[model samples]
Structures are given as structure tokens and as C-alpha cells.
Target: MQRRDIAEMLLLAALWGASFLFMRVGATDFGPAALVFLRVAGASLLLLPLLAWRGEVGALRAQWRPIALVGVVNTALPFALYMVALLVLSAGLASIFNATAPLWGALIAWAWLGDRPTPLRGLGLALGFAGVLWLGIDNASLRAGSAGVSPALGIAACIAATACYGWTANYTKQRLTGVPPMAVAAGSQAFAALATLPAALWWWPATLPGPTAWAGAAALALACTGLAYLLYFRLIARVGPAKTIAVTFLIPAFAVLWGAMFLGERLTPTMLGGCAVILLGTALATGLLRTRRSRPAGSPAP
Candidate 1:
């Protein structure tokens, strides 16, 4: 990848990493539904204009069903789940759970798409899930955090959110295949906004949030959701999806750092170890890490 692509990838990771921090800050004031609604709504405002400029509105219109499904499955539901998790779990811990999506995606593809995993990938799936269970066993306690919610509930929510993401990945591959990325991004955000609007209104905070909370929520929408998607698709175009997806590995580190720095959240040894194990498993599961076999001297380059 070019230096510019590398920079963009890092920026994308950082933006996404900060999303946890933003949600942790804003979810309390705005409530999960309202915060998520604002996020997708704001992201739509940012992306829809660009979609129109690129003349991709027709693509979105034609593919509205699948794209709307993606909006609910991918953007709306998982996002709100993450917000709920953030209420109880630290940004770093929640991001570690988020990293397990690829492992679930690989498993889902194997079952749903009949795309069987290689032996190495199968091992990866096992190892990645083991790491997840390890983290959950250690951290998913019945003890409630300051939010009066149990960490176990938070952990379960994170896992459910990742499952939603896992499902969306295969669904998009199967169903949304020829749709323009911009259309999918913009349309999904718009539909997510629509889907969550009633919940947002119903659960809207009784009092207005302060400026800091508003700023965090707005940044979460505009920068993390909107700009991050643009950067993600750009990196995919330039460096290919395999390389662009490496941003997932970097996100936990940034999330940990940001959580520690801004929120004064402590990083436990267990969390770090779990993060490492999860990333390693994800790498192998996603074929970012692969085993090579020796070929015969005269073998064809098959």
C-alpha cells in the first residue's frame, strides 16, 4: 500500500476507535436509541449529499430492500447494542469483543455460504472463540458497574452485536453484490435513521445534554461513522479489502489508548492478553495470516 493509504487506514482505525469513547461519553446523556439515531442521522446528512453528487441515488433506490436490511442489521442494531455495552463495559473491553466479528463472520460464511474454511482457518475459528470465552469467563461477572448494569449483560450485548455484524457481512456478500459502496453506505445510514427514529423519540433524554456530550455525539456521527466509512471504502479501493480490514486489528489498541487517556479507564493485563489472543485468532480466521506449503521443484504455479 502507498503511504497515503497507510495514513488513511490508521486514521480510519483511530476514528473508529474513538467511537467507543464517544459512545461512552454520549450514551449516558442521549440514551442508546437517541444516540444511535443521531449517529446514523448525522452520518446520512454527511453521506447523502456525496451520493447524490456521484449520481448513485438510483443504485440506492433500486437496492433499497437489502440496503435497508443492512441499515437495521448492521448500523442500527449493532450500534445500539454497542452503546448498551458501553454503559457497563470499558471502551477497551467492548472493542475487544468487537474484534471477534470476523471470527463469527468466518463461521457464518462456512455455514451459510458453503464456503468451507481451510484447516488453518478452522483452527483460527476455534482459537478466536476460545479467546472470546476466556475473556467472558474472566470479565463477564454478575457484578454491576456504576451504571447499575451487570458486566455479564454488557458482554452478552457485545457478543450479540458482533453476531449482527457477522451476519451482515455474509448477507452483503450474498445479496448486495453489485451495489455501489457509496449508495450502500449512504442509504443504509438513512434507513437506519428512519428505523430508529421512533425509538429515539420515545427514549429521548428528559433534559438536554451538555455541550461536551453533544460534541462527542456529533463527532461520533460525522467523523467516526460518516468520514470513517468514506476512508474505509477508499482504502478498499486502493489496497483491497484484505488490507483495509487490517484496520480492525489496530482499532482495539487505539480504543485502549483513548479510553486510558481520556476516560482514565484502567487497562488490565487480562484485557491486553485477551485482545492479543483475539487478534491472532482473527488474523488466521480472516486469512490475514496463512500457512504456506512447499511445492515440488517442477510444480506449476497453480
Candidate 2:
């Protein structure tokens, strides 16, 4: 990859990694439903105008069913689950757990799409899951020694959210391959906003969020959801799905950095190790580390 492309990939990683921190902060005042609702709704409002400007509004109207399904599985469900998980889990830990999405995606593809995972990929999945199990056990140990809610449950929620993401990724690849990524992003968010509206209303807090919470929500919607999707689609277009989705590997690192810098959260050793393992597993699953020995260096290998 060119240096510019690498830089863009890193930037994408930073943006997505920061999303976990934004969710954690926003979830303080808003319930999971409200937080997710605002995230999708805010992004939808911003993107709708741009979509209209690009003459893509009809794209949404045309593929309403697939778009709506994508919204439910990809945005609404996983978003809410991550937020709920954040209520108990550290942002860093939750982000690391969410990195397991590709592993789950591989398994889903094997079962649902008849795509066979190679041996190395299978081993990568096992290692990734083992890391998750280790993290869960570590969280449980910490919680047992404290007087608060069990962190293991939080990790579990994040893992479940990643599974949903995994399933959605394959679903989109198989079902909506030809749709423009922007249309997919915008339509899904709009559908998610609509789907979450009732829940948001029901669980709406008694009072409005303070300035900080509002700021966090705005950032989540505008930066994380809106701008992030633009970058995501750009990467997806430049690279194929496997390479583009590899951005998730860097998210935990960025999440930890953001949490430390903004939230004053500690960078635990366990968190670092977990992040490394997850990233390694993701790399293996994506075949980023595998090289063709049959081809000479500095030459393209098939």
C-alpha cells in the first residue's frame, strides 16, 4: 500500500476507535436506546442533505427493505448493545471485545454462505476467542473482588454485539453488494433512527443532558457516524471488504489512547495484551500477514 493509503487507514482506525469513547461518554446521561437513536438520527439528518445534493435520495426510497434490515442488524442492535455494555465495561475492554467481529463473521459465512475458512483462519478464530475468554475471566475476577456489577457481563454484551456485526457484514456482502456504500450507510442510519424512536421516547431521561453529554452525542453522531461512514466507504471502495474491514484491528489501540487522553482512564497491561491478541487474530483472519513466497519481493503476487 502507498503511504497515503496507509495514513488514511490509520485515520479511519482513529475515528472508529474514538467511537467507543464517545458512546461511553454519551451513555452517561442517555439510555442505550436514546444514545443509539441520537447517533443514527443525527447522522441521518446530516447525510440526507448531502444525499439529496448527490441525487441519491431516490436510492434510499428504492431499496427500502434491504436498507431497513441492514439498519436493524448493523446499526440499531449492535449500537444499543455496545452502549449497554459500556455501562459496565471499560471503553478499552469493550472496544477490544468488539474487535472479534471478523472472527464471528468468518464462522457465520461458513455456516450461512458455505464459505470454507482455511486452517490458519480457523486457528486465528480460536485464538481470538481465547483472548475474549481470558478477558472475560479477568473481568469476573476483578468484579468479584469489588462491590460493583460484574464486568464479565459487560464483556459478554460487547461480544454479542460483535457477533451481530459479524452477521451483518456477511449479510451485506451477500445481499447488498451492488448498492452504493453511501446509500447503504445513510439509509441504514435513517431506518435505525426510526426504529429506535419509540424506545428512545420510552426511556428518555427525566431531564436533558448537560452540556458535556450533549457534546458527546453530537460528536458521536457527526464525527463517528457521519464522517466515519464516509471514510469507511472510501476505504471499502479503494480496497475490498476484507482489507477495508481490517480497520477494526486498530480501533482498540485508538480507543485506549482516546480513553486515556480524554477520559483519564488508566491503560492497564491486560488491556494492552488483549488489544494485541485481538489485532493479531484480526490480521490473520483478514490474511494481511500472509505473503506469497512464490513471488519475488517488490512484485505483485497473485
Candidate 3:
């Protein structure tokens, strides 16, 4: 990767890492459904114009079906779930859950596409789930019902969101290959906005949230979803998915940093240990480490 590309990758990680912070701040006031709606709605407003500028708006019509599916699975649903999770979990903890996406994606690919995971990748998946369970149980007591959403529900929401992310990554690769990344980004956001608009209206707060929450939502929309996709697609073009996706490993660190400094969230021992295990597993799952492969797979991952 070029120097500039590396910088962009780092920036992308920072932007995405901060998303948990935004969600943590905003989800309480905005509610999960409304906050996710605003996120995708706001991002669509920003990304679609850039898509138009790139003359890729036309691609949306051709790819509308898969794009819409991607929007629902990848953006709308997961965003809502994670925002719900953020309502209870610390930004740093939620961010650690975010790192599990690749692990779930790999398993989904294995099951859905008949893409066999080698022993190393399987071990990674095992490790990732182990960490997630440990972290979840340690961070929050699993009980039948609590006054508000239980910490355990929050944990389940986060894991399920990552599972949705995983499934959709495979769905997109199978259904929308060769579509311009910008079009995918913009179109998905637009469709997500449309999909979730009704839920957002129904769930909208009777009383408006404070300025900080509003600002957090705006930053989550424009900077994290909007600008971050632009950087993400550019790096994918320059460095390939293997290198660009490596940013996943770095995001939790920045989330931990930002949460500690800004949100006054502390890193507990379980959080640290679980995060380390999850990232190590993600590295293996994402092919950051050398893993055994079969010949039918065509070639080993980079």
C-alpha cells in the first residue's frame, strides 16, 4: 500500500471506531429504530450526491434488488440492533462486539456457499465465539427480565448485528459483484432509509433528545457512515480487501481510547482479555495470518 493509502486506512478505522461512541451517546435519547433511521437517512443524503457526481447513480436502478437486500440486512437491521446494544453496553465493549463481524461472516460463507473453512479459520471462529460469550456473561448478568433492556439483551443484540453483517457481506459478494463500491454504499444507505422510515416514525421520541445526542447522531451519519465509506471503497481499490479490511483489527483500540477519554468508560479485565482473543480470532478469520487452504479454493488468501 502507498503512504497515502495507509493513512486513509487508519482514518477509516478511526471514523468507524468512533461510531460506537456516537451510538452510545445517541441511542439512549433517539431510541434504536429512530437513531438507525437517521443514520442511514443522513448518510444516504451525503453519499447519493457523491454517487451522482461519479455518474454511478444509474447503477442503482440496475442493481436495485440486491442493493435493497444489502441495505436491509447490512445497514438497517444491524444498525438498529447495534444501537440497541449501545443503549446498555459501553462504547468500547460494543466496539469489541463489532470486531466479530468477520468471524460470523466466515462461518456464514462456510455454511451458505459451501466454502470450507480450514482448521485454522475454524479455530479462529471458535476463539471468537468463546470470547464473545465470556465477555457477554461477564459484563452483564443474564436474567429473565429487568426494568429496562437487560445488559444481556444488549449483548445478544450486538452479536446478532455482527451476524447480520457477516451474512450480508457474503450476500453482497454473491449478488452484487463488480458493482461500483460507491453505488453500493449510496444505494444501500438510500434503501435502508426507505426501509426503516416507518419504524423510525413509530419509535420516534416524544421529547427531543439533547444537543449532544443530536450531534452524536449527525457525526455518526455524516462522518462514520458517509465519509467512512468513501475512504473504505478507495482503500479497497488501492490495497485490496485483505489489506483494507485489516482495519477491523485496529478499530477496537481506537474505540477503547475514545471511550476512555471522552465517555469516561473504563476497560475492565474481562473486556481487555475478550477483546484480545476476539481480535486475534478476527485476524485469522480475515486472513491476516497464514492459514491452510484446499486446492479447490483456487488459491490461498493473501
Candidate 4:
């Protein structure tokens, strides 16, 4: 990759990593549904203009059904789940769990799409789940977060969210094949915004959020969701998905850094160990590492 490509990838990772921070800051005031609604709605506003400018709005209209499905599964549900998880879990830990999406995606594709894993990838799946189990066990305290939600519930929410992401990967490949990337991004966000609107209204916070919370919401929408997607697609177009997917591995590190810096979140030894194991497993499961010098069944691009 060129220096520009590398720099863009890093920026993408940073933006996504900071999403957890933004969620933590905003979720307290806006609540999960409202915060996620803001995110998708704002992202839709940003990307729709670009789609119109590129003359791909027709593609979105033509493929509205599948794109809307992707919006609900990929954007709305997962975003709300993460917002809920972030309420109780530390950003660093939640970010590590987020890294397990590929593992789940591999498992789902194996079952649903017949893209079975090689023996090495089977091992990767084992290792990844073991890491998740380790982290979950370690953090399974019944104590509630500031919002009075249990860490266990938070863990469950993260797993559910990642599973939704995993399922969407195969769904997109099968249902939305050949759609323009920008159209999918913009259209999905638009549909997600619409789907989440009622809940956002119903659960909107009684007390108005402060400026910091509002700023967090705006940044989450404009920077993390909108701009980050643009950077992600650019990298994929320039460097290809294999290299662009490296951003996934880089995100947890940045999340940990940002959490520590801004939220004063500290990591435990167990957390660090679990993160290493999960990333290692993800690398193997995604075919980033070769075990027998032969390609495994392809995992879909992130």
C-alpha cells in the first residue's frame, strides 16, 4: 500500500474505534434507540447527497428491498446493540468483542452458505470462541453499570450485535450483489433511519443532553458512520478488500487507546490476553494466515 493508502486506513480505524467513545458519551443522554437513530439518520443525510451526485440514486431505488434489509440488520439493530453494550462495558472490551465479527461471519457462512472452513480455520473458530468465553467469564459480574444494566446483559448484546453483522455479510453477497457500494451504504442508512425512528421517538431522553453529548452524537454520525464509510470504500477500491480489511485488526488498538486517553478506561491482564487470542483467531478464520499454503473458502469482505 502507498503511504496515502496506509494513512487512510489508519484514519478509518481511528474513526471507527472512536465510535465506542462517542456511544458511551452520548448513550447516557440520548439513550440507545435515540442515539442510534441519530447516527443512521445523520449518516444517511451525508451519504445520500453523494449518491445523488454520483447518479447512483437509481440503483438504490431499484434495489430498495434488499438494501433496506441490509439497513435493518447491518445498521439499525447492530448499532443499537452496541449502544446498549457500551452502556455497561468499557469501550476497550467492547471493541475487542467487536473484533469477533469475522469469526461469527465465518461460522454463519459455513452453516448457511456452505462456505465451510478449512481445518486451520476450524481451529481459529475454536480459539476465537474460547477468547469470547474467557472475556465473558471474567467480566460476568452481576453488578450493574451506571445505567443499572448488568455486564452479562451487555455481553449478550454485543454477541447478538456481532452475529447480526456476520449474518449480513452473506446476506449482502447473495441478495445485494452488483449494487454500487455507495448506493448500498447510502440506501441502507436511509432505511435504517426510517426503521429506528419510532423507537427513537418513544425512548427519547426526558432530560435534554448537554453540548458534549450532542457533539458526541454528531461526531458518531458524521465522522464515524458517514466519513468512515467513504474512507473504507476508497481503500477497498484502491488497495482491494484484503488489505482494507486490516483496518479491523487495527480498530481494537485504537479503541483501547482512545478509551484509556479520554474515558480513563484501564485494561486488565485478562483483557489483553483475550484480545490477542481473538485477533489471532480472526486472522486464521479470515484466511489472513495460511496454514497449509492453500486458500481456504473465501470470507466475505467487511
| Tens digits of lDDT, candidate 2, 82-137 | 88778777788888888888889888988999988777777777777878777777
C-alpha-based local distance difference test score of model 3: 0.89
Structural similarity to truth (TM-score) of each candidate: 0.96, 0.92, 0.93, 0.96
List runs of model 3 lying over 4 Å from the truth: 143-147, 291-302
Which stretches of model 4 miss by more than 4 angstroms?
295-302
Query: Model 4: per-residue lDDT, tens digit, 21-66?
Result: 9998788889999999999999999999999999999999999999
Worst 10 residues of 3 by lDDT: 291-300
Task: Quote model 2's TM-score.
Answer: 0.92
Q: Can you write out model 1's per-residue Cα lDDT over 1-302, one digit (the tens) per residue?
A: 88998899999999999999999888888989999999999999999999999999999999999999999999999999999999989999999999999998999999998999988888889889988999999988898877777999999999999999999999999999888899999999999999999999999999999998899889999999999999999888788888888999999989999999999999998888888889999998998886555334665432
Q: Quantify all predictions' global Cα lDDT against the true fold.
A: 0.92, 0.82, 0.89, 0.92
Candidate 3 C-alpha lDDT tens digits along 1-302: 78998889889999999999888878878888899999999999999989999998889989999999999999999998888778778889998999999999999999999998878778888888889988987977665333277788888998999999999999998988999999899999999999999999999999998887888899999999999999999888888897888899889998999999998999999899999999888877666876445333667556
User: Which candidate model has the greater lDDT, 3 or 4?
Assistant: 4
By lDDT, the better pick of 2 and 3 is 3
Q: Identify the superior model by TM-score, candidate 1 or candidate 2.
A: 1
Clashing pairs in 3: none
lDDT of 4: 0.92
